[model samples]
Target: MTGMEPLAPLATAGRRIETAIIGGGQAGLAEAYWLRRAGRECVVFEARKRVGDQWRERYDSLRLFTPAWADGLPGMTFPAPRSSWPTAREVADYLEGYADMIGGSLWAGVRVDSVEMLGDGSFVISTTSGQWHAQNVVVATGSDAAPKIPEVASQLDPGIRQLHSSQYRNPAQLLPGPVLVVGASQSGADLALEAAQAGHETWLSGRHPGELPVNERIAGPFFWFAQNYVLTLKTPIGQKLRPVIRHGGSPLIRTKRADLDRAGVHRTPARTTASIDGRPTLDDGTVLDVANVLWCTGYLPSYAFIHPAVIGPDGYPTETQGVAADVPGLFYLGLVFQRGFYSHLLGGVGRDAKFIAQLISERALSRNTVAA
Candidate 1:
């Protein structure tokens, strides 16, 4: 009725389980679902105060790129119409309902501080609430854990308002003047279009990742083809294209080039290459004097809380399709390209989670037999 209903707290001190899933978003919830079917005891630790706060915390103008029918986790289908493009609030509500329906082991308001592997091939999770010893640890914290803003931001004048896309809630959150949105990713394009629509002189800068044939609106037979075929990494061509898309960023799926043109949003070079006299400078030597700047440059994967040995020098966990190699009981979920192209998407996380659940179950069976 008011704020989110707080999750009943668990006794955090010395809790032990078969698995510990971090970050109670789609990835963690999906893991919990299949683990329950396997009768594996697991717990989810969410940093947010509420169940669906992750999606709810994003920008105000956000909507799911995928159709509602394709956005569900393992067993729970999203309740909206199949063709509908759900709002961020709808997604948030759906996640909350999903959590409630599953009734799995979850601890909200608990921030995972550190995860360490013991010599006995087990993991110890340290959190704001308490400690947990888990036989297996699944890092489902997702790709958006840390916002990546360039160091050049410090060079800008203090008079020009600047914030990462994560911090942006709406156009009203920005100062009244020309708005500069850096990064041509979906978030950047959508925000730029929104700013322009709101009467702000908006400039969008970044390398175009290209646009999808269909968006949330005016989707037809092409929508099904794009969703079920082209975007999936299971195909040979899709596999070959994964690296390019991953490094370049996802193509504009929701906001199209025509939308930007209609909104009168100006385009610039791929990045803010430099700063001149407290103004934003692009790669092509274009200097923009804007009052507000939104950095949609994307997020850095933050696994700092995890031990260095668990992660590669590239800042990713040494995992093959969610199962870590060097660490006996360490696993990862919700990462970009974890297994397939859709791995990070809401619809795709469940498949990866199910696979990981099978691995966890096999290991458990082997251990029990040996002990017997």
Candidate 2:
């Protein structure tokens, strides 16, 4: 969809809406786009002061692994060249621009405190700002809510500077000394390389999570292949691999193995398990005397505000393709493999948004007809 399209009207703060979408990132924005397209009155409640604060808050050198053309949501295309990988700031800015273009009921800084289903079958969305009523609620908060720093990290010395991937902004944030980075996934590799390039001695410690078969320079073919064959649940291979992908972290995508080697970042095979006498210790009993540690350990699914039934004991929401079969009118988007592998991605959210929007529209129409 063209970004030039006429924007829908913005929602007034404190007003009750028919549908309430939590989070104003790409997923929530995509949901809002489709909901508005179906003539549904919805309001997006963002916790951050701005729409793309999530991306803005990431590390300084972070960029989209995919090209610009592959990073668009519903009703808008990212404004960068098709093949160019946009920096984190660029992607964040694009999201803000996309929200402006949509102009559809986005309420930034309205953090959702709790979501409870009322006895009357409607939902009461309580936020930091105020309470709002909605016939339907879509949790588009995306997958990354809580940073997954291990409990053992606290055992480290107070003098040592340790930061999670979410808390990391730039190499300058680290103390002046050798840096130890845990987790050998894309984020770990990226941070190690960046630290090395910034003239810091960097040691990357963790199990190698494997790498993508394709190179990073030309991501188009690999993207097409994965989207078509690997990511989709319809395929037999995808069905078999879905469970693995869900449980395991994705292989290195953005950072290549050669890139890390070229940057002179030392690679260690053991994971950093804990600290031994103020020094970080590896799983193999090796203690590292690094001044800084960056935990690229990824995040956990945190939907604690939702009802227990909506979320399984595993902490993940139980839903089928964005639709809540158990809880009618309660849907989810931006979850990993919600429908496909790209469900949490920018381009993929739009497809799920289209499906969820249709379901919501139908339910609303049915209720109106019953009332009539």
Candidate 3:
């Protein structure tokens, strides 16, 4: 079958393929595009029933920080005004459409369970549907694999409603009293502003990570160029800034601290360290008695499905520019700083995908030649 054709249904037994990509998000879809261009046989397995369900699962009020011009994948341009910031649903629909346009082997609702490298260097992937033996495996799962909630959350009174940012859709999900939003990063600030606007007494705990120095609209092209090319792993400045960006909260993009202040969001530049008498207490000994606690604390990378040896001590894959160092034919995509600062971003991920796809294609071609 041609590369554009849908992958055939697998038998009860293991199905062997040239390449298997895990996660059908932007990264996986980008890789699929390039692989298809190279005439490679591959399959993209996504856990959700439909492509872009991940984006659709986000909060109702969520809008991308980047403009439409910067959100396109590999071949297709985002179908919106260049300056418009697309909503979560818009991005989701765009992704679904991109998948349809690519016309490759995409299997939805199939969750990958495990990825184990055998003695022969081939990977045996266990999935919800069946097993597959792949010569090359690309782990394109993005950074936000699992929601990260502080352990102190368990100590809060069960009477108070608690919702992680991932589970938060609208202010309606909150209790009818004061709302305490923990973590003042992009997500936290957005949620706090929403709660305050919805007429709730909002307390935003955590320091602001600062904002872009200039207006994004005017500096759009320059900023995009810097992020896409300049602030990369290859440069000394980018290397120095990598750890800081990875550990620190992401700087506010669309929402500024002044906006939150105008909305009357009480800003607390301290962490919520404890729960005292069923109330959240700040590190400075201030107690907040709130009916709803929203956690915008962000997420943690989960590599439990992959072999432990391939993962680093920091709980991420040990790879160089998406290629796994420990295992041949094993690669990663959509990782933060995988190639550069924008490696995980939609417009930037395609670059990394193309690089990995080229390597995979070259290796496949070499194998074929040796066999001949």
Give candidates' CA RMSD values in order. 3.9, 2.3, 2.0
Candidate 3 stretches greater than 4 Å from native = 1-13, 219-222
Worst 10 residues of 2 by lDDT: 2-11
Which stretches of candidate 1 lie above 4 Å from their native place? 1-12, 215-234, 308-310
User: What are the per-residue Cα lDDT tens digits for candidate 3 across 1-372?
Assistant: 234655454445377899999999999999999998887888899999999999888999998767889989978999999998889999899999999998757889999999999998899999998898999999998878999899999999999999999999998888799999999988899999999999999999998788877665755665578778778998998887776576554577777888899999999898998999989999999999899999988789988888734677656788888888868999999988787878888788999999999999999989989889
Estimate the overall C-alpha local distance difference test score of candidate 3.
0.87
TM-score of each: 0.92, 0.93, 0.95
lDDT tens digits by residue: candidate 2, 215-261 = 77666558655864577778787777666566555778878778899
Each model's backbone clash number = 1, 0, 0
Model 1 misses residue 153 by how many Å? 0.9
Q: Estimate the TM-score for candidate 2.
A: 0.93
Best-fitting candidate, measured by lDDT? 3
